[model samples]
Target chain A: MTDAPAPGRGWVAVVGLGPGDPRYLTPSAAAILAEAEDLIGYFPYVARVPERPGLVRHASDNRVEVERAAHALALAAAGRRVAVVSGGDPGVFAMAAALFEALEAGDPAWRRLTITVEPGITAMLAAAARVGAPLGGDFCAISLSDNLKPWEVVTARLEAVLRAGLVVALYNPISRARPWQLGAALRLAAEHRGSETPVVLARAVGRDDESVRVLPLAEAADAPADMATLVIIGAESTRLIPREGATPYVYTPRSVEAAR
Target chain B: MTDAPAPGRGWVAVVGLGPGDPRYLTPSAAAILAEAEDLIGYFPYVARVPERPGLVRHASDNRVEVERAAHALALAAAGRRVAVVSGGDPGVFAMAAALFEALEAGDPAWRRLTITVEPGITAMLAAAARVGAPLGGDFCAISLSDNLKPWEVVTARLEAVLRAGLVVALYNPISRARPWQLGAALRLAAEHRGSETPVVLARAVGRDDESVRVLPLAEAADAPADMATLVIIGAESTRLIPREGATPYVYTPRSVEAAR
Candidate 1:
């Protein structure tokens, strides 16, 4: 067989940097970043990456995901390996959705580019791990961002997931302009689950100021949650395991009987 | 501030290597491995690490978790920085559990050991990320191994998580000797969720020959799942999005319209 003609040059790897720490970055993500000539991502997220030689950084505003996606596509079309980075798992409420949308809608040249979304330790996973194994069953992630969607629709899905007994990982649960939605979400969740189904509030996970609190579902609504917090609502079998000399953590499906 | 202990000694960062691939290893994990003088883990998992000098390897069998934990604790207790490794995220179904269990049960002399479990990409997280984000909402993770716990208790937790309407990430769902339990899990999930809720069967995630299939919950009982497969039961809003070049993926909340 004839030798392959360099196997189509334009390729992009959408890497997820995880929540707030550099340590959670996947090895493949680092490898791809080290090789890529250009990197595109949100401003705050872009700032997280260390300055490297020969790397061109293109930081964009939060609302400019579409433009960022276009820039990545343009770089890839120019035969440069471009990386569109996101803080958490790129596929979940991050860059992949916008990238795919922009790529599909924009120039035809990008259609030939190979796009790969390199996974990262998402905030939810990091938060869940820090507390306990609450993500131990049927769960769904919902974003409370109504900028692109309607509030009614969001509540409907939330209600369905809640009513169906799926554990919920709420992203964009509360932003500066959208504080009320979180309360609405908690109410929806409480309508189905008991007021006491463990709710883990994790803030700045894997970061210096990391704080974790295992509270009831009702109390979670009143907590000081911000953009950095990832809320994990446990299922019915969740229990508070009190470890000596350590902060209390919530573990789901406790095996007390099995251990005995 | 007491100088933070000179940046090295008494600091042990035990990491998870994930399922079975070097690529699955996170950058932080690689960094820890690169710095570790003595690396400890299960035998099969220890063999998975790339060959390197300046590192000592401690391999144990399935029955020696407590011993391994004690050994690592001893080394740390003696001020020797060590890396206690495990397959999958250390915090999820791996060394972290055993480490904490040993800590809770061991003599008080070892109680002061400063042990940190650096989370790796768990098999279920890797699997869920590979699929279309089935873990977007409230989800639960359960292990089917009755080795440590009774099957009756496991089943109860499964049913509890199911009734809570959370997505389920099943670990140890099946094995060579125990295959029927997964079917039972599927049946239980189907009882709570609609027949159309997506169920992803991901096997050997992040490794060569990784296979991912999306089916309805009703059909999950007959899906080609095994011990290696991580079964993810999607939430009610999870939809199957089919693309030409890309494989069909399960996307939960179905974009902004449903996200709202």
Candidate 2:
């Protein structure tokens, strides 16, 4: 069935599924997914797409992004419409970069295949939206996993982000293999930020099991920092507004002058 | 019409429209817009929404974010479903911050109103998707406009981003009133990055006049840097791959070890 395609040139699309929520997916991404003949991604993300007769799903284990990317590229080169799916915005710590890496090193013929990336709602953005806007001001996103980068690099960047007084969003803060990284990163952050700094723990944002918790940095050490969680540490000017008989709202103001 | 009785409770949704393209707008944002009785935003953004008898559009000039946010809050407080629209993800340098500011300082009663933020495809994400994924790894986004902050803050952050070797995305790089800011920011970036570093100039992304240009850091200074343009400066690991009969694809590999 895959060999039947001769209607148009084969193409590859690296698409973001947007934090496990169908509502967060962009129209462009949905259209591309509908047209794809082959879908490749991590097992959990690939399971999100409904089974269809014409589409073939290739699910792989985590930590094998490069190999999956190569498979998608090869399929596209053979005149198949292939889609590489990621849970969040593919550009942010996801499959888009891996796809490009494979394309740059693979057969030059793979470079000729039409490729495009369709952006989706990243985890941080979805998490921020769910809990008011903790990332409303100048903020930086850093991944805490040291599988690809050194621990020193992450620490140095954390220090720089803290010194600059920018709101910080930590992705992959902790995993089964690295249980202590989140605590260590928070200690580094606490060194520069005040104890009163607000921290938001948004787990499984936009998903069925989603949960959100807002606390001061002093208490954030006890919050969950699992693979599916996003940690947003507020800047000095961030505020937490408690209301009567309702959950409090957390946000960082717009103007630096106003913040001061 | 303003005095209508409360049907349930008044609410405000600060929504992102996604870099001027309707397709980039998320399904969640679209649903919120459809239910909004009033919409408020900067002129260009408000103009994007279709005209409808039930929807009252309040278009204001630029730099009045605080006032516009206040207006939306007031309408919502008076039993109206108000949608405050922004061009990109509201949490990233957009209306979300302004709305929070207004809510914090406005009437105490305003705090009781239901308010939610709907994330959209931010400009950087859209621009990054256009060219390959230059933001695939650790990255930081900084606004070049110094209207709310000191110029030194922008320069200092640029230096920090460069020193940390993170991919950088510059928003609001230049406007008629700040034509020299983009050049100065690029000069600061060039001091840290090599002349061969790739830069992406994404102008009016997702709009009718959208144009994307990829060039080396040395040549990027000559490209247009208006308010509508987003400048992406690649990290040391970023690579530009040129293909036959196709635009070059630029992406930062996922593995930091490969970057070294």
Q: Against the true structure, whose DockQ is highest?
A: 2
Error in Å for residue B162 of model 2:
0.9
Residue-level error in angstroms, candidate 2, position B141: 0.9
- Candidate 2 clashing pairs, residues 3+ apart or interchain: none
**lDDT at A44, model 1:** 79
Q: In model 1, how large is the Cα lDDT of residue B192?
A: 82
lDDT tens digits by residue: candidate 1, A1-260: 13222336768777888877777877778888887778899887777878987778898878788788898888788777788888877766787766766765688767667777777777877887776556544355667778776787677667666644456788887888887988888877888889988888888898889998888888888889888888877766555656567755555442334423
Residues B1-260, candidate 1, lDDT per residue (tens digit)? 43233323654566778767787677778887887767888887787877776667888877577678778777766666788888787756676656655555666666555566666777766776665455654456677777666777667766666654456788878887786988988888888889988888899887777898888888879988786788888766666655567666565542444331
Task: Provide the lowest-lDDT 10-residue window in model 1 chain B.
Answer: B1-10
lDDT of 1 at B106: 66
Docking class of 2: medium
